[model samples]
Target: MKYDGGAQNVLSEDYYNLVIDQSGNKTAQGVINVANDMTISNSASFLTSTNTIDVSEQQRWRNLNW
Candidate 1:
């Protein structure tokens, strides 16, 4: 999954499991309470992309995951 724009794009959500693999799959490390928006790319299994999702993470609304 990637955004249609470049730096103009932003991470709108921060509380869901995502897939970061070769087969384009969805991963899960359980539910984690996100305090702020951030890019979490790890090998332990956890999260996507767009306009090349290489973009940074940023939150917009609040308590959307709660």
Candidate 2:
């Protein structure tokens, strides 16, 4: 995943999770973004090659009025 904008305005909490299975047969990716809040929970058990998780970038907006 990639964001090309100048910044990412996340109003509240954000979370993500990823899972991969052995033999490189299964994989999963999850993302949670909310205007006010966000939450994510995940679990997995496996082993494989090229099974990696990465976060490109993150940015928050400033309260212009405050």
Candidate 3:
């Protein structure tokens, strides 16, 4: 999902299993959590001088052949 706004947006830890695709201009207050099954595709940038990219990679295999 794409979060576009003028103010700073905060990404919660509740969305640990969600697929988030970032686009447009956005400002965040803290780090963004990347889930094991989640993928963040940043087509555009919303980074500032103070902002940082701190994403965690949780590697796990899913049974796609089921």
Most TM-score-accurate candidate = 3
In order, candidate lDDTs are: 0.30, 0.26, 0.44
The per-residue C-alpha lDDT of model 3 at residue 52 equals 52
What tens-digit string does per-residue lDDT give for candidate 3 at 1-66?
A: 445333335564434443334455444556555444533345534543565544445553232212
Give the alpha carbon lDDT tens digit for every residue of 15-55 in model 2: 34221212222222333332332112122222224433233
Tens-place lDDT digits, model 1, residues 1-66: 322221222244454432232222243323333444423232222242322222225542221222
Top lDDT prediction, candidate number: 3
- The weakest ten consecutive residues by lDDT in model 3 span 57-66
TM-score of each: 0.21, 0.17, 0.37
Clash count, one per candidate: 8, 0, 0
Order of candidate numbers by lDDT, starting with the best: 3, 1, 2
Q: Total clashes, candidate 3?
A: 0
